[model samples]
Target: MQLEIISRLPSTKSTKPPILCIHGAYNRAWCWDKYFLPYFAQAGYPAYALSLRGHGNSAGANRLYWASLADYVHDVAQVSQNLAQPPILIGHSMGGMIVQKYWEAHHSHPAAILMASVPPCGLWSPSIYLACQDPELLWQLNLIQFFGLRFVTPSLLKKALFSEPTTAEIIQNYLAQLQPESQRVILDMLWLDLPTLHSQPTSPLLVLGAANDKVFPQFLVNWTAKIYDTQAHIFPNMAHTMMLEPAWQKVADYILSWLQERKL
Candidate 1:
């Protein structure tokens, strides 16, 4: 597991606790580096992004196709344990699911944030909803899930993750860095890897969603928040990749405000 540390000063001198950002499927720590890592670091919080095994420059890239969700959780757990103090875990999409699993296994973080997270019930609800709402889009995602990178099309990618305000250059850069995710992990999301919700999480949790997110839309995000007894905030005019979306700073500001409100 490779931890991409974004620190301006020594951790001991920071006013806020470190933040550990976990990227979603087909993404790595590099995605966080683009906006989140720097934003949080500049906000006076030390930040670190973890490249789960087989993703980004992390070890085992060659065997990623066969890796499971549990394996990804292990990567997160390792990074969490190595941190100087429990970090505020922030995860998006599949990474959010991974954070849920980590919290279930070890409730060490002071707080957690789920951005366009996979629902606690698992991928079935979102999958079924997308299938019903947009069969054509679902079909394209299915193609990518099973067949990998070649199945992806620029138009589909843009519609799936971005909105009208996002420029072509940003979308192109994101696509160029996007890689094929593990089929095994996708399968786990669909079936084998549902997060346990029986035990209420001890840490304060913030659940966020984008109004235009194709994958985990508002309905699913709200459902996720309901299970945790928290509110799901839906940002208008944004899509799945909120961190990289044109209005990314808005999301960052909200998170910072939330942290301050909670006194974390």
Candidate 2:
């Protein structure tokens, strides 16, 4: 399968392992291009982001709705295999869950970072949490899943993604790039496909979350960290889409520091 792999390299090559970023549902590799790819690369780490099958410029759009979580995992594996060296995986939201499954299968990555990722228990807890905490946002997201961008508005999109003030223009730009994600993959995350905790990877792990994240709340982030036996870091006043927020550099810098400390 043809995949879109967007890359950025530092002017002076370093021995740092390449960083492969995985985007979440409704987003593609371009989501990382705006901030993460360049930021990581500038810090002397080669950075790349892949548009999962049916997302961004990747192939299989016609079969997107039928794509399963396993298919997404395979896509990650395929990209990882072709890299010159094993990559340090960084995943956001649903993409974080994909990283977990990929690590479970291979267990060879240098490290893994989960940013506002779905919990290993799956989406049930967060789904129920959203239903109770902010039913309107949940309803709006459901509408977008079946109805697409027409159901999204600047205010609602901001509520779901950004806790910091963001201009309507930026919100609209992201809206234009948004696309329908696979229903099959959604179901897989909901119940069918989840990480196997019996054998965990020994690679260093970083679990990050936003205090204002409505989708995957701080509790879920804590749960994910607990399952992985690591501490969770919840940034104050941030939301689900940290990479696109006004304070995106804060998140990027934190990750860079973590990587440097581990010397990965």
Candidate 3:
């Protein structure tokens, strides 16, 4: 339940609520601290990133393999409970699925941002596509997460996460920071723990995707947006890890603009 916060309160104490960023599988709050947290904070809105129960510096690292998707939801809910008010939830990949589940259980947020997220349907489509097109990449991912080792080569990492302009040094640093995720969460994504599509929340949703994202392509992002009756803004020449990409500032700027337009 630990949080990494970047606070920049205005002299008069602005009325804007903070943003809570939730990281995806194999990642932690540090993912947001790298760019989004500071960028948003500099824009006059406090931002926070949460380390789920077993990820990063949070507790329950030893119990990761046995932790269920519900456990992840509880982690998010607990963090929400501690906030002054329900913060705008910005979730990435598996974290997006967690946000969806959180909404189903308790729809209490100003808005939600789903970035390169897993679709509500499930992980089956993406898994099958990767297995067919690049089985080796999928195999390496499994090796890294399930076996608690890093098996990803630089080429594969670039193919799956980054775009052409990304430097090798950035890729190396990010790869080094990658951690193992819960096996139960992986299994749940494939089948058991998909989000509830029936009771979808009507909160303002901003769905953003990258054109070059090999994991969740534009089509998948559009599908999620369509379900919520919105259009997706696809960033060109970017990949799955858009937030950490070289042009991350553009993404942050767009989100800031959207928040202003919606008055959230």
Among all candidates shown, the one with the greatest lDDT: 2
Clash count in backbone of candidate 2: 0
Between 2 and 3, whose lDDT is larger?
2
Clashes of each: 0, 0, 0
Query: Which residue pairs of candidate 1 clash?
Result: none
Evaluated with TM-score, which candidate comes out highest? 2
lDDT of each: 0.86, 0.91, 0.83
Sort the candidates on TM-score, descending order.
Answer: 2, 1, 3
The local lDDT score (0 to 100) that residue 258 gets in candidate 2 is 97
Score candidate 3 by TM-score against the native.
0.94
Better of 2 and 3 by TM-score: 2
Error of 1 at 15 (Å): 3.4
How are the candidates ranked when ordered by lDDT, highest leading? 2, 1, 3
Q: List candidate 1 stretches off by more than 4 Å.
A: 1-12
Which window of 10 residues has the lowest lDDT sum in candidate 1? Answer: 3-12
lDDT tens readout by residue for model 2, 138-229: 88899988877788777888889887587677788888888889999889898898887887679999999999999999989998999999
Model 3: which residue pairs collide? none
RMSD of every prediction: 1.7, 1.0, 1.8
